[model samples]
Target: PSRTEGNTRLYTDEDLQRLEFILNLARDLGVNISGIAIILQMRERMEEMQRQIHDFVQYIQEEVLSRATAATDASRGAIVPVRRPMVTPASQNTRKK
Candidate 1:
């Protein structure tokens, strides 16, 4: 709304408060809206990168665990003997001819 008594237009109290906030942010805090937006974007990118790294690490760990388990089972199957029979040596050699 504007008053017809003067040529210049006046702003409402809410507009003044918002303008003051923007001015203080630029002047007092030495921060601009562009810089703040860039910072937020960079932070979001960093978080995404971190999540990807974590997922890769977990995939590598699972792969390593699966390989280890398969290797253990193969080794167990390929092993020659884990126990021996209680038999006399003379008796064992007698059947070999």
Candidate 2:
């Protein structure tokens, strides 16, 4: 109901908190405004990923920790990734078969 405003919905306190969180994240990461917009678009995706990580930790705790409790996972099941070459724009284009 922000009719006096020029075509922008006034954000509530909770919305401000969310926007603040996104802005803080962007600031901490040194991301640009456009990048921040992209991050906001994927905000729900980021939240989902965090939730999944929490669920996975709980699973590992119930299954692994219960069987053999440790100070931490340590070297029990660690993952190491290999580096890959950057994708060139020419290669990035998806071609139809």
| Best model per lDDT | 1
Residue 32 shift from truth in candidate 2, angstroms: 11
* List of clashing residue pairs for candidate 2: none
The per-residue C-alpha lDDT of model 1 at residue 81 equals 57
Predict model 2's lDDT versus the native: 0.77
* Pairs that clash in candidate 1: none
lDDT of each: 0.81, 0.77
Put down candidate 1 lDDT per residue, 1-97, tens digits, no spaces: 4755766778899768766766776788888899656655786799999999999999999999999999898898575756777886688668889
* Per-candidate clashes, comma-separated: 0, 0
Please list the residue runs of candidate 2 whose C-alpha ends up more than 4 Å from where it truly belongs after superposition: 1-12, 19-37, 68-97
lDDT of 1 at 55: 100
